[model samples]
Target: MTNDMRRDFANREELATYLKEQFPEAAERDDHISPIIGGRQAAVAALQKVDPVKYAKSRNFLTGAVTRLSPYIRYGVLGLREARDFAFSKIRNQDEAAKFVNELGWRDYWQRLYMKLGDGIWKDQEEYKTGYSASEYATELPQDIREGTTGLVCIDSFSRDLREIGYLHNHMRMWLAAYIVHWRRIRWQEGTKWFLEHLLDGDPASNNMSWQWVASTFSHKPYFFNRENLERYTEGVYCKKCPLYGKCDFEGSYEKLEAKLFPKGEFVQKDNSQSWQKGKRKR
Candidate 1:
């Protein structure tokens, strides 16, 4: 699939030539691609009105922060460098531009990590066992979670949004990860796989790394969410109407889990205990 020239060509000249011949002027005039491109132009026009400050404050708030550029990015319709440069050009303020730039950096970082680690990053880490199991839960569990049936108000709402629109707020992504890892006791890898399968903008590195970060496998501290945090963040949009609001038992604790994975405030050791124990046994 990666080698499919129709999707991703190394040179624009080749792509342009192909587009020109395959879609002559008369055909191009009547084709749907023109309208789709026109729509993107319209969206860009709207975004240009907001500029930097609006994007910085609202980007993480489950609203209009997203660029909706994923389909173009994924299909090679918009090249990565093109998006980066355009963002930088428009949002000239250092801090405002930095927010968008950092997100792009995350994309690059994930790609590099995937290339460097390959399948190893997906392997089970013994360190993840605390407060959660790495096993795939019953299919019903995922279905319930995805379908917003888990009863956790915030998670259910986000899950429903994802199912209906294939999108979730940035904060909601973290919330969902915490719920799946801490509340559901499911493996981050499983959650990552699920998102990759369903998300319209899913990229392996971002999905895996984000899951690991929430699972507390990649960072020194495990991310946890409490009802108060949810209420505050979501502006009381959740909890009141949740199916599991009163009945669920998970408390969203991370102190012990963080200590186990990230002792003495250090990043989690990359599970080298096997080699250490084997060497000691040999002695």
Candidate 2:
């Protein structure tokens, strides 16, 4: 609670123990610490492994070759330009680094919007396109969701990973946000708060804007996913073992899900096809 708080610790474990002792309430909620190390050395080491070519190809999948450098970037241990420059160093040309660079550009865009919008970023940029009034959405996140006991295997797993590891695959983040806002009809701000509380890379601008994007308050349309799309990207790892495999909420085509989740909204069809699908053309 004081500026004179201890800064010296023998190791990460000691530091964690000290933090838990100082902040018992936080520990009670979840004592878990992320395995991702911090500091410039770790950031540089992570940056050294940047494979823009492979990242462009597999970044959407659950087990993709992601750089996992967001925490470093978020905390300023590594700079965005530094990461981009390093990625460029490994690539043959602009096309090879386009996807990776594009992602970095998105982060920059979000931050710029955050600076421009100020506190306005917390408010909806536009009325939600989901055809529901703001009053229709629940303001509080459900207890089951916060506890990671939703019983839907994929969702529960995502919730658990978020609470325990303080990170999620970008796809999982989108799916979870969509589920909370569109599927469960909870307000996106509630989900946004939860993500900020836990994500190691939780940049308020990026996190808030992303939830708004899913909620249709900051995008042309709301984003949702079907089981087939989820399974294809995640290699069916969660669906294959889920007790609700065939009967789960996500078990349907994009058209079917669209009708169900946003019944009152003008339906805009989103591509359900996986980006990594071989032999299938991008729509």
Candidate 3:
């Protein structure tokens, strides 16, 4: 079974004693650098240095404004509460501090949902009934999506960014997920697994749950994005650079794609069996 829950170390004193015995090398090292310590320190420093003003203004820029702390959280290097407290302690006002806190809450929610649902959350209900096949599709779609060869410029750029840095902007993740599910008709579980394999911040709870959320499996109504939303949110930054700006079928709009997938009031729900099939295929 994949362990997706976070663990607490009981107390700092006990944790220190255990680390001394279990990790002698780490204990002796003066710098004491690990995912948790490094992540907490990095978060604290970012909070102290940037605080409300910088984070508020530049968090969405996608270049370098946001704190890259997901790997630490994913690996249990840093506890969620510790990170939250550190940020709250640094910020003077509650309202401004809430922005960062809400982001952390999202992490907590993903984990909670995973614990509550377990593997059932990953299956697709429509596959068996509709005779939706995944094996042949999985072999091809993952390569095309990961290689950025799907002919979708924004998605390709996001894929390339993830391959190079194991990171993508928050907005880019949603856009990529939507395109992969609705436009490409690839299984979200397949896409989610591919991400976990490559992403430095591959937390099962967050990664899987977020993919389901985007695919609309968690909700009755599937969340779809269009060209206008992209243009407004991305500030038309992707318009000129995207390879599929006008030539491709989607044309960077989800309305047409949605109509095609769910014609005659038929909703395109995610198939959870895709997750298990993917696991078997990987083995």
Candidate 4:
């Protein structure tokens, strides 16, 4: 073959077929490709649909009004300022867009931190505060979890979505991370690698830092959630049909969960309502 290569295709399927033929090994490894389109046009279309007010009110839920612009921003097909300006144009007041803007601010913060930390972000920033030593955590991710057959409906769904769709709601991301680290006692780095492999918007900085946050290496305490908290945010969609409902690992009060998950750690727990009031204090 010469330096010149084919760049034109009649459709996405033709493109996918050509790619698979050229990179058969990659296709063998994991052939699933995301349905989310690329390029500036697709990015602008996604940006035009941003609903900041609805996002602020419902971003925590599974079917909320999330602006699916992360992949575009991550790849520079869309710029952060462009997204912010467009969101601001849609909102009537500053408060209406505060939460959405705050999310963008976090992306900026993670990028800056990545620049400073370099490769150091992959290592633990601090000691794990879960009362157990680093040696106690498992180094390998379990096959069941990776295959989305762990039998917990919520977790399995998230795992499948991560692998197949290359996307997940932020709340679901948190819950899944918590399950891997706290419940299964796996090292955060393992989960980090799994996410980076599948997420289209996965940036090492944001992904690693967030994993460390849940692992308690970058945060004050290990983040976790009770059944009630999960059900409330997910609207009980997973729990209602979950075969292990009421008997699963997540079924308990926050206080009970804290004591069980981190018996030797110093993570404090108050009543659910009071503790979860500020930030991730409840977890």
Candidate achieving the largest lDDT: 4
* Candidate 2: tens digits of C-alpha lDDT, residues 1-283: 6578898889999999999999999999889998888889999998998899999888889888988898999999988898888888897787899988888888888898888999997898889888898999999999899888899999999999999899998888988888899889999999999999999999888888878877878777777888888998999999889999899999777788888988898866666432211111222
Model 4: worst 10 consecutive residues (lDDT sum): 272-281
Compared with the true structure, model 3 gives a TM-score of 0.67
Full ranking by TM-score: 2, 4, 3, 1
Model 4, span 21-78: residue lDDT tens: 8889978978987898888889999999999999888887778898889999999998
Model 1: runs farther than 4 Å from truth?
1-50, 124-126, 129-142, 243-283
Off by over 4 Å in 2: 1-3, 272-283
Worst 10 residues of 3 by lDDT: 274-283
TM-score of 2: 0.93
Ranking 1 against 2 by TM-score, winner: 2
Q: On a 0 to 1 TM-score scale, where does candidate 1 land against the true structure?
A: 0.66
What TM-score, computed on C-alpha atoms, does each candidate reach? 0.66, 0.93, 0.67, 0.93
Over 4 Å off in model 3, which ranges? 1-64, 124-142, 252-257, 266-283
What C-alpha RMSD separates each model from the true structure? 11.2, 3.9, 10.7, 2.9
Q: Candidate 4, residue 249: CA error in Å? A: 0.9
Tally clashes: model 3: 7
- Give each model's whole-structure lDDT: 0.58, 0.84, 0.60, 0.86
lDDT of 4 at 40: 86
